[model samples]
Structures are given as structure tokens and as C-alpha cells.
Target: MSYGKKEFRKRLLILTVLISLSFLVLLGRLWVLEIIQGEKYLFLARNNSIRLLPSRAPRGIIYDRKGEILARSRPSFSITIYPWNLSQEDLAETVKEISPIIGVKEERIYQTIEESQSPFNNIPLKEDVDLKTATKILERKLSLAGVDLQVQPRRYYPDEELLAPVLGYLGEIDKDQLQALRGRGYRLGDRVGRDGVERVYDEYLKGEDGGWQIRVNNRGQRVGTMGHKEPLPGNDLVLTIDRQLQQVAWDSLKGRPGAIVVLDPNNGEILSLVSAPAYDPNLFAGSLSQEKWLSLKGDPLHPLTNRAIQGEYPPGSAFKVITTIAALERGIASRDKSFFCSGTFPFKDRVFKCWKEEGCGTLNLKEAIIHSCNVYFYQLGLETGVDNIVDFSKEFGLGKASGIDLVEEKKGLLPHRRWRKESLSRKWFDGDTINLSIGQGYLLVTPLQMANLIGAIANGGRLYRPYLVKRIISPEGETIRETRPRLIKEVILKKKNLDLLRESLFGVVNEKGPSGRRTGTGWRAKIEGIEVAGKTGTAENPLGEDHAWFIGFAPYREPKIALAILVEHGGMGGKAAAPIAKRIFEAYFNSKVGEKKSRKVEE
Candidate 1:
């Protein structure tokens, strides 16, 4: 009995030690939870009770130089569901009830909820909801336990297709963009700029989004407002574009496949820019339908393309100006140098034919430019050589991007001997030089580049960087930034040479029946009150008819506007493009006169 008592006491002592160790372990875990990991657990617990809801700030408004609104925001309603607040059965019931009303599939709603990154955050079931549907959802709020109607700002374009390419459009941030931008406070449902000025200046246009903390019950229903922060609106942009001039340029295209660019030669301020086959940007304001999106993407005309800076084509006879500058600069040709054109140029074994079959007899440099004599330029190019031509073309901003503020600008091709040897694996030949001299073979330029080049000539050899936005204003009406005229380069030329070239260009438009011809090539560009100097080009295209081109500046003396027009597959520049230039010049000068009269009246 004594031994049994001893063994029982020993077992009891062991059991007591085991119980103490278990209690100590429990106390250790409790300390870790209450102290070491306290903040984390506390945050998780707070999140369960208080939900942070993000609110989108209004995007900046875009305006023309005259303060006309181009882009703004409108109040829109959206239906969203808080997945964490609803049980599986409640979510099913809500989806069944709201799907038919919202015109969305029940499966889609369920998928949205399932794919949501955060169950506590609201998942948008349907955006851009109609008022009647929103009213119905509100009335049935008790039945739809986790669903709520929220008002948000949606982008709205006033003029629609008028400024579609320049203003661009916004869409929901994609997964990749979300991943890249999440650290910057961007969310899945946030809209982001996709093209043009919107994409380029998104940082300034996208305002800081705000958020609200609200106390919620276990059911995910808001019980009270805990805290809130107001969203900061984005800054406004004032463009140098004149709405009237933009409209005129768009209208002058006349639904043709072409582009027109007008600029203030002195300041590089873009007055008007238009690319044909434009689409309504409003189509992208809301969720674009698959059919509509496909139609635009599949259209053969490529309406989405901004052709002014993107299209690459041979400048044709318009490039003669560069050739002339090259020759004059190299002292290979002069205003008095004469070349006889017998309708064809014989280089080695091949003969290149001129457009004028009978040949333009004996012609001086100025007369050649006026008549667009191919043979004359061919000789001049041979004399100037390929290297000199390429150098001068580069100096004229040809075969290069004009550094416009727009995106996707193509640097046109300027073929040289090295490029030929490397790219084509062939030595540069005389035929190649002759062809490039006339801007026919392997030489290409964007209309923007041509406009900038002409702008340089009109502004006395000063090349300015083409810019669209003139100023940026803060929400509080303070000037945040203003764009000043930026000179890019200077074309070094004697004043006499420029004057001579300018005079020759003036004759191409103003002088008629010169050199015993019926009319000058650019005679159709003449305006009664405006003395316009211009160049006409018929670019040969391998696919179809020649592309028409015209580059010019108005009021030959103290020119203010420099313009470039391109029409795809148009027959002749003199016949097709020059006439368009005349109309634009007329409208521009007429508007200037009216503005002057208005100012006088005010005075």
C-alpha cells in the first residue's frame, strides 16, 4: 500500500508538469498574437469592419485656343456588388434579380464577382447604367442585399469625330496596365488615355483619386461614414488649335483619303490638323460594342491612323525645293544655270522619261521649278550628287520626324549610298541618284515634315518644334505651364538665295503663262488678296494613281501660315492638291480679316 501511494504521487506530479507546460505554450502563443503580430491582426480586424471606397476624380477638360470645350465629364451611374457582404445564396439571388434589369448575363455577373481581386471591395456589375434601371435597383435594394448604385464621372466628348484623333479616347485599364500602374493608385475600373494628346499628357490630365472609409456591418452594408477625402480635379489644357480652322481643314478634305496640316510658321503653333476617314470618339466613351470596334479595326481606309505625321510618301516635285537648295548651296547650279529638256534623261543605258513628252525646251532654274521640268531636276541632281542631296534633304527636315507632339510619327526614308549598299546590297548607281533627285526613288517624307520644312523657309530658315498645347491651367485658374516657341534648327542659306527661291515659288502660283506654257503648275492656288508661293508634287505610287501634294505659305511677303496637303491616289498636285490649298488660304485670310475688323470695332 505504501509503494502504490508513492507511484500514484509520482504519476500525479508528472501530469501536473504536463498541464503546466501546455499552459505556458498557450500563454506564449497568446503573447505572439497580442504583441508581435498585433498590428497586422488589428489591421485585418479593422478592414473587416471599415471598408475603403475609392472615388474617381474628374479628368481635365480640353479646350481650343478660343476656350471651346473639346472634352469634359458627365455624371454616370454604375451598379456594383460587395462580394464579401453576401453569402453564396444571397449572391445568387442578387445576380438573378439584377441581371435582367441591368441587361447583363447572370453568368457574367457571377464571373465578375468570382474574378474580383478583393471580396471586400466593390465589383462593378454594370457601368453606364440607365436612370430607370438605377431607380429600379434602388427600389429593390432590400432584395439585392450586396448590390449598390454609385454615381461616377464618365468622359464625354462634345464634338465627337471633329477632334477624335487629336483628343483621343479613354478605356478601362487593362490587366497589364493595371499591374504597371497599381502603385500609382490606379485600379481595375479606372479609365486611362489610349492615344494622341490624351495618352501623351495623361500624367497631367489624370487627377489624384480620393477615397472614403465607411463603417460596415458583417453583412457588408454601410452603417456610417467613418472618414472621407475629396478628389482633386485634373488640370485643364489649352491647345493652340483654332476650332474654326480645324473645322475648315476637316471640311476641305471632303471625305477624301488624305491629310491637311496648317501651322503658324513663325511660332510652330499648329492651327489645324486633319486626317481623313475620322471616326466618332464618342463610340469609345462607354463600353465599345464588339461589332463597332471590329468595324473600325478592319476598315480598309484605316480611319484610326493619323496620316499627317504617319503617312510616308515621296514628296515628288515638291522636293525640288530641297534639290534646288542642295544645288545652290553646293554651287553646282544657279538661278541662271540652264538645262535643255528633250522630254527624256539618258543615264548610262536607261532613259528616264519626263511627264512633258515634248520636253520643256531650254529652261533656267527658276523656270524649271515653275514648270516642274523633270529633266532639268535630273541634271541638277546629277551635278549635286547623291551625298549632297541627302545632306540638304536632312537639313530641310526631310526623311525625319518633325518632332511634333503627336505620337507614331514616322521618320521618312532618305536613301543614301551606304543605306543602299547595306539595305539592298547594291552599289549606288547614277539612276538611283537621278531618281532620288526628283524625290521619286526611295525618298519619302511625311506631310508634317514637309510643312515644317516650308515653315522654316517662310520663317526665314528657323525650324521650330511643332506643338499643339499652348498652355496648361490648374483647377484653381492659375497657369501651371505655358509652351513658348522653341526653335529647333536653322537652315544656313544666303538671304539672296532664299529670296530668289521665294520669288520663284511665288511665280509658280502668281505668275501664269510664263515660259510660253498655258499656265504655271501652281497657278490654281492663287487668291485675289493673298499672294501665295507654293510647290506642287505628283508622287508616283506603285499601288495606284500618283499621290497629290502641295506645300506653301500664304501672303508671300511676311507669310504667317504654312500649309501642307496630301491626297492619296490623286492624279496631279496642280489639279488635285493646289485647289484645296486655295480654299484653305481663302478661309484663313478671310477669318483674319474678320478678326481684324472685329478688333477695330472693339477699339
Candidate 2:
């Protein structure tokens, strides 16, 4: 009996120890679950069966001068697929089913399904699809594996007819852009701004995209909205252009190819920049048809080119003003500095003839510019010398870029001794300087440069850098920054010399004297009651027809507006380009708004 009791007590002790150890393990597991990995496990548990959804931010709006909507976004349907939620076996069937319905190849679908990584709810099948097509896809029950349809926003151009080139176009994000913005919260399918306002203000234009998480089935379906970061809407852009003026400029082009640059002489704000052969930028929002893209790309007029800033041409006689400035500053020519114009200058085995067959005898500096005398400047150029001419030209913002707030601005050619030697492998000569004086032979400049030059002369010999953006505003319409009327440089010439040159420019419009002979089209084209001072240009193009240019400032007493008009392959500058200027002037001064706000032109 004693031995049995001892064995029983030992068994009881062992049992008691086993029970205590089991309780300890249960407590340890509870502690770990409650403290160490509670949140992580909870997230994992929900995520295993839930779907994370992303809400794309709405794009910004573009408004013109009068608060008219130029560009906006509209609702559309996008087809997407979730790669992580679907099984690898289902990927193949998904491809087979989606291919026939969407007319997409099964191979491409399979590749996307097989290659995608991470928890992505949107695997785009076709973005920017038509609403009708979207409805058909949904009703057809052609739902490919892992595919879901959702609402997507796309860009729309309301006034595409008015502004096209100024707005520019957007295109697909290639590997280059993708690589640049790889992990900076921008993904492969994000539609970035490719050009114009979109490209210039891409960060502000593309608002932050947001998302949420929800419990989903193993079949990869959205069950509910989880954690959401609401996407911030992009700021609306308000431009500095009058819609009426823009429309008139567009209508005036009348199918001929040309460019117009209009700016406020006081602040150098680009009021309007018009390029002909423009197209609706809406064509680029989605998948552009191959035919439409080819037509636009191969258009004869090169509609895509912003000619105001990019096109380079010889300034012709229009360059005489720069020559005059150089002459005045160098003391090579003065108000009464006389040089005979025999209509032609003798070159090496070549004689260049002036447009006016009649010779100009003993012309003063002012008279020389008024008559567009070729020989006078030819003689003045020799006195000024090539080096001095180049130096003075640099002071007026020639040979260098204006640093305008746009893309692809050309630095027009102003060849010097070094440029001639480096580029042409030839030495500079006297003939080159003479040619440069007349704005010919390697002295090319864009219309913007011409306008800026005129603006400088009008604003007391001080050059201001040209800019398109006057200021940028925040979403709440608060000015983030305002541009000041900045002057770049001033040419230090005797006041008398500056006065004489200004008087000569005034003669071109106000006086019909012997000095101001109507040689180019600018003579016949003049607006009544408006004393517009201008210079006409006709440049010989090596590739095609001659390029005609006209640059001037209006209401000569106090210069308020400066404009540059360029017509490619058109006739004389005075006839072809001057009429365009007349229309632009009419649009400005005749408008009731302008007349009411017409401030006296300041000297």
C-alpha cells in the first residue's frame, strides 16, 4: 500500500508540471500576438484578402484673359487589371479572353499579366476610351481575367480653334522620362505634360494622386475603401492674352504661314504669339490615330514650329537701326554724318544693288535709316569696323539668346571674325561687315529679337529681357511671384545721337519727306490717327522663297506696344508684312478696352 501511494504521488507531480508548462506556452503566444506583431499581423491578415486602390488626381484647368476656359478635363472609362491578385494559371486564360474582345493580341496581354509586380489595382488595358466603347466593353461581359473598368479623366480643349501652337501638345511617357522620374512617386502609366504650359509647369499641373485600401477576395476584387490620401487638384492657369485679340490674329493669318509677336513695351510681357497652320491640341490627349499624327507631322507649313521664337531670318534693312546704334555709339556716324548711296556697292567681282534704284546722295545718320540706304551703311560699316559692330550688337541682345520662358529658342546667327574662321574655315573681310550692316550675309535674327531691339530703343536705349509668363498664381489666386520691368543693358551714346536716331524712325511713319521714301510695303499700310514707326525687311532664303519681316512700335509719341511680324515666302516686307501689322494695330487700339486704358507713351 505504501509503494502504490508513492508512485501515484510522483505521477500526480509530473501531471501538474505538464499542465503548468502548457499554460505558460499559451500565455507566451498571447503576449506575442498582443504586443510584438499585433499591428503587423493585422495588416498582413487584411492585406492578404484586401485590395489597395489608387485614385488619380484631377488635371488642372487653363483659362484665357477673360476667364474663358481653354482647356479642361472630362470623364472617361479606363480598363485595368490587377496582376498580384490573380493566379499565374488564370493569367493565360485572361489573355485569351481579353484579346478577342478588345482586339488586342493575346501575347501582349499575357506579358503584362506575367510581368507585373506588387499590389496594383490598375493594370491599364485601354486608357482614354470613348464612353460608347466603354459601355460596350462592360455590357459584353468580355471581362478578361483580373480586368476591371473604372472612371478615368482625360483632357479636353474647349477653344482649340483659338490657341493651338501656344498650348502645344502632350505625348506618351517614353523610357527616357520614365527613367528620369523612376521612384519619385510617378509611375509608368502617369500622363506627364510633354510640351507648352503642361511641360513648363508639369509639377503644378500634375496634382498629387491618392489611394485607399480595402478588404478584397482572393480573386482580386475591390471590397471597400481603406486608407485614403485625397489627391490635390492642380491649379488653374490664367494667361495674359485677350481672347478677342488672339482670335483676330488667328483669323488674320488666313491660311498663309507666318508668325506674330506682340508685347507690352513697358514690361516686356508677351501679349500674344501666333503661328499659322495650327491644329487642335486635343488630338494628343489620347492615342492619336496614325493617320492624324502623320498628317500633322508632315504638314508643309511646319505648324508645330513656334516661329516667333524659333524661326531665324536675315533682318534685311530692318537691321539698319542696329547699325545706326553701333554707328552712333562708335562716333563713326552722326546726325549729319553724310555717306553717298549710289544704290550699289562694288564687291569682289560682284556689285550688290539696293532696292531703291535711285541713289541717295549725302544722307545724314537719320536720313540713312529712313531711306533704308544700303551703300550708306556699307560705308558706315567700314568706318565702324567689324569688331566694333559686333561689340555694339552684343549690347543690344543680338548673337545671344533672350532667355525667354519657352522651349527651343534659337540664337540667331551674328557671325564675327572668330565665327567666320571657326564655322566657315575662312577669314573675315570688309565685304562681310558691309553685308552685316545691311542685315545680310550671316546676320540672322528671330522676330522676338527684332521686337526686343525695338523695345530697347523705345525705352530710352535700355534692353529688357523678353518673357511670356508675367506671374504665376497659386490655387487660391494669390500671386506667388510677380515679374518686374527688368532692363538688361543700356547703350551709352550721346543724347543728341540717340535723339537723331529716334527722329529718323519717327520719319518712317509721320513724315513723307525725301528721307522717308515709301520703299517697302510699310509706306502704304498706315493706320489713321496712329503714328506707328516701323522698319521693313526682305531676306533671301537659301532653301525656299524670300522671308519678309516688319518690326515696329505704335503711337510713336509714347511707345506702348511693340510687334514683330514675319511672313515666310511672302513678297516685300512693306506690302506683305505691313498689312499684318496694321491689322494687329487695329485690333489693339480700336478695341474699346485698350482705348479706355490707353496710358500716354512714356519716353
- In model 1, the Cα lDDT at residue 128 comes to 88
lDDT of 2 by residue, 270-318 (tens): 7777877677788888777789888878987777777777888888888
The 10-residue segment of model 2 with minimum total lDDT is 594-603
lDDT of each residue in 371-414, candidate 1, tens digit only = 99999999999989999989988887777787878788899899
Give the TM-scores of the predictions, in the order they appear.
0.90, 0.82
Model 2, backbone clash pairs (residues 3+ apart or across chains), number? 6
TM-score of predicted model 2? 0.82
lDDT of 1 at 158: 82
Candidate-wise lDDT, in order: 0.87, 0.75
